[model samples]
Target: MSNSPSRSVIVTGASGGIGRAVAERLAADGMSVLVHYAGNPATAEEVVAGITASGGTATSFGGDVADETAMANLFEHATTIFGGIDVVVNAAGIMPLAPVATMDLETFDRVQRTNVRGTFVVSQLAARSVRAGGAIINFSTSVTRLQLPTYGAYAMSKGAVEALTLILARELRGKDVTVNVVAPGPTATPLFFEGKPQEVIDRIAGANPMERLGTPQDIAETTAFLAGPARWVNGQVIYTNGGAA
Candidate 1:
């Protein structure tokens, strides 16, 4: 592995939940983090502040991961601020659950644009910009295997992400870059529990084998492993769920 001292990482959707947790965790591990948020600059700033306050290095930037130009600018900013990127965690995604019959085409398209296209835009930039021994960690969900009825659109988007991971791993065969995906099951993010009744949330939690919903920190630990010491592990979608899938 490349023993570069500056170890910089870029994390998308860093304003909340899994993204926020991953950014903080990576920074704590002594990696300079670039926290990327699509909106909510205040939340992004808060994440940066928390990391810096804890004696970790972090900076926040805003850009839509779905837009190639915006993603390009994000990469440029990272290079300017931290010299270069050594890892990228693509954590930007949305899960709007609606049965296929009732799901609006526009909503479906939005999900695809952000989850699939956004991941592609960022992963490609990571591939081109990150140093030789860098790692690219993409987000996926265990819903693809669970095959829930209302999650068709969301699962489709993540399915594309899984395919992208496999192909990117092959494409970067000799460059020493590792591309992998982390699939979490029923994480307890605001996005997951938003607007749900207490009983509904309880049932969802009970459904998991662990009898509790996953925390952002749980997912972050997996990301940190993939991003850092687990260099031998590559081209695999490691499911970090507590056997829920």
Candidate 2:
């Protein structure tokens, strides 16, 4: 691995929203970033271009976090392009809401596959590859604490992430690598606003103590901190929810 201060970091789901913000922020902090996306090549390229244009180093790769081969390729490319990775942020997730009685099994399964299993796969790779003094940041949600209706499946998935972070931290005890999770409140993202009426959106936003939904940048800030210079903080789910949770 290169001994340069500019370390390499990977941000999964960097096509848009919080993932994009996190990738850009890390790049701005002088890290060589690997921006991973699932299907949106254009968006991923846009992120990479934005970083490079700003005099930072970044590259975009398209791969499903749930696929083992794709994830292997992602790590290989990261190491090949920017040297060994020092940080990994697992920000890829899906939230499809429905009452448990009415939710389709397929949809629930997909949520778990992407949100829970995807984190597992990426974290596993990071465990084997990230250098000492590095960190793994996983995504959870404040909804798990809120216990909101129609979010059972999503909360369950994040709960799994919380458990994973705790266990992984213990497993990595002597490695100087910290494992943690970030649980954000309702954020103002395309995914959050999709299919929701204005009234419902307003209510959701007002539900939080801050009286407004979070911005992608808000969540990104916490992720950036966890990835660098937050080595003493580990095995904890830091909830950045504007005091809502």
Candidate 3:
């Protein structure tokens, strides 16, 4: 393994969930990491602290992923501080559920702005900033395939993400940059567990042949693979869903 500390990465939404796990995993892999948070500075700091305590290099950054200016600045800062950026994981997002029949325009817009626009903005910046041999990993959801009720807007946003991922990979043709998306199914993050009853959760878990919920670490390992050794896996949507969907 060419685990080089000179390699640096930016992981957005690193304050919690899969983002945090990616940050930690990259740090352990000898990559300096920038832990980014949308609004939770404290959680971001905690991640940074933990990495540094374990002798891994990491720092915290804050920005709204959907804000072009903010994202641009975040990229500039990462490049400036780390000498150059080798990877970017756009893991920041928001998910709100409402049936399409009764879904408010405001809620739909909110989902689009954050999930779709945020991904577009981050991917654009990453395309321009990442060095050759780098990877740009974006987040999509397996829900896009599962097509669960009340997830119409979310699925639509991720469908767009799938489009962006494949197109971006082709566009980066000679740059040695791989663009891909990770679509997780029924992860056990606080976000996934928020309001669902145990019975509901159990049913969802059983839908997958694995018969269990996925952990953030499960997704993080894939991010590590793509960011480092999986150079040939370009423009692919690797489903880290334990065979769900």
Best lDDT among the predictions, by candidate number:
3
RMSD of each: 1.3, 1.8, 0.9
- Among all windows of ten consecutive residues in candidate 3, which has the lowest summed lDDT? 1-10
Q: lDDT of model 2 at residue 138? A: 95
Report the C-alpha displacement of residue 16, candidate 2, in angstroms: 0.4
- lDDT per residue as tens, model 1, 9-107: 999999999999999989888899999999899999999999999988898999889999999998999999899999999999988889999999999
Off by over 4 Å in 2: 1-5
Show the lowest summed lDDT stretch of 10 residues, model 2: 1-10
What is the Cα-based TM-score of model 1? 0.97
Q: Which one wins by lDDT: 2 or 3?
A: 3
Residue pairs whose backbone atoms clash in candidate 2: none
- Tens digits of per-residue lDDT, candidate 3, 106-186, equal 999999999899999999999999998899999999998898998899889999999998999999999999999999998
Candidate 1 CA-lDDT value: 0.92
State the lDDT of candidate 2 residue by residue for 1-245, as single tens digits: 22244698999998899999999888888899999999989999999999999989999898989998999999999999987899999999999999999999999999999999999999999999998988999999999999999999999999999999899999998999999999999999998998889999999899878899999999999998888878789999999988995
TM of each candidate vs. truth: 0.97, 0.97, 0.98
